[model samples]
Target: MNQDIELLAAYWTIAGDIYPMGPTEVSPFSFENRMEAAGQAGFKGIGLVHNGMMDTVDKIGYPAMTAILEKNGIKHVELEFLVDWYLSGERRRQSDKVRQELLEAAEALGARSIKIGPGIGQEIADVKLMAKEFRLLCQQAAEVGTNVVLEIMPFSNVRNIETALAIVERADQPNGGLLLDIWHLERGGIKFSEISKIPARFIKSIELNDAHKYAIEPLWMDTIHKRVLPGDGTFDVPAFIKAVQAAGYEGPWGLEVLSDTHRKLPLEQMANRAYESTISQFRK
Candidate 1:
């Protein structure tokens, strides 16, 4: 694969979301199968959710799981979906357990980052306290040779690029940074002009997905099941790409389409479409 396309990643959702019922009557393929399809489609990296990674390890052993990725020529691995780190008491404790396991898994797999967010509600906590908690998480991640990237969701505490940047700056950990997902970027009303203001060092990762210019009713549902492939919707993907590139953020661009429609496709078709659609944006 060429260097540019080699920087493209296929996220786990491109395979399936690990639903018990599967993405469709025929889907929800195994982790090994997903990796092989993604590799064959020219993706150099693959994303894994925390629970999915643990389940795969339980089934195949960590060594075998990593071996599958290696055989597929997958170089970058990302673990995701850590939540409630900003809460206290039982919630924080529960988050800690999952966080620890994900950290260890990331270390084991030499993952690029652990994707985390405040989840689907508005957070009213003190920004400083949030930064402190994030700093602690970054320290833990640092010890394991991984990065902790805060994903900004429209309904979450870190709801915009400005807020996400504030938390990252206050945390002041080298490994603590922001994960910019294009769907969330548009949903949060952040313009590409604003994205250009961020330094490349603080932009830890970039995930690509497309959605309508106007939000659908009950936003979360659309986010989970309706995201379109790059260039298939109203998002100004080429502008977004140009803005990030202008900011000097040179990293793997992750294809993170979480649509029910996408999941229903056969693995090879899904992977190929994701790779082609994403690469088409860069071509523009």
Candidate 2:
């Protein structure tokens, strides 16, 4: 089963020594090291955050980064977490700047997709406006020969499949789709059966991770510091995987563990555990 499926090491999973929301979000490890660890752990692809990508591109350039990826047998690269896309004023301007950088990186790296989402802890009053803005983003991504995948979070305005699907339906772009994370879906209280109802084309990607059945208070804390390996927590990882597969999702499964404990492990150990634990779910 592991041989048949490709696993992607999401940025947070192997992001060495980075504070997620702190002033500095760059990983201390070199890009080559991260790729090497993931590749050695049997991952076919890897993810990078915006700041990390910028730092690497500035330090060694895209050609060097590309060479390292080729050296590691990484076929798929996922770039992520673009927010403030649907807003206006200074925020929208800043969002546009980041969006351009991500698109450029995606085109240069031949990345599989760029992950985006609505703002966390904020709700948009108009879904149609969000759709309009998302359509533009998708069009830009398509021009670069990549797709834009939307991740739904409980803290975001579009928290459930129903709302997420509505936005994607309205956007109506083939490359504009949903990123269904097992942690988010389960934490948000969305049913596994809801995934069965989504059209395959709309299910662009999926993430794997597990957590306690009940989230800790101030949910964001739990997501960042309490996530466990795929089968280590109470999540029904197998069922979620089955639902996504049933919906015809054929892309790599993103392993996005963000626990404090996971981050403390040695690079090789973290990568190994992430790959081995998630792959075991498929065998089950």
Per-candidate RMSD, Å:
2.6, 1.0
What local lDDT does model 1 show for residue 117? Answer: 84
Model 1, TM vs. native: 0.93
Task: Please provide, for model 2 over 1-284, each residue's C-alpha lDDT reduced to its tens digit, 9 standing for 90 to 100.
Answer: 66889999999999865556866778877889999999999999899889889999999999999999999999999998799998899998998999999999999999999999777998653689989999999999999999999998998888988888899999999999999998888888899999987899999888999997778989889888889999999999999898888889899999999887888888999999999999999987
Clashing pairs in 2: none
- Model 1 scores what on Cα lDDT? 0.81
Over 4 Å off, model 1: 5-10, 17-27, 123-125
lDDT of each: 0.81, 0.90
lDDT string, candidate 1, 1-284, tens digits: 23564544545456564332244322357888988888898889888776667777788887898899899999998888788888899988999999999998998898989988865577654678889999999999999999999888887777877778888898999998988888988987888899877778899988898986677778887787788899989999989888888888877888888786877788789888888888878888
For candidate 2, give the lDDT: 0.90
TM-score of 2: 0.98
How many clashes in each candidate? Answer: 0, 0
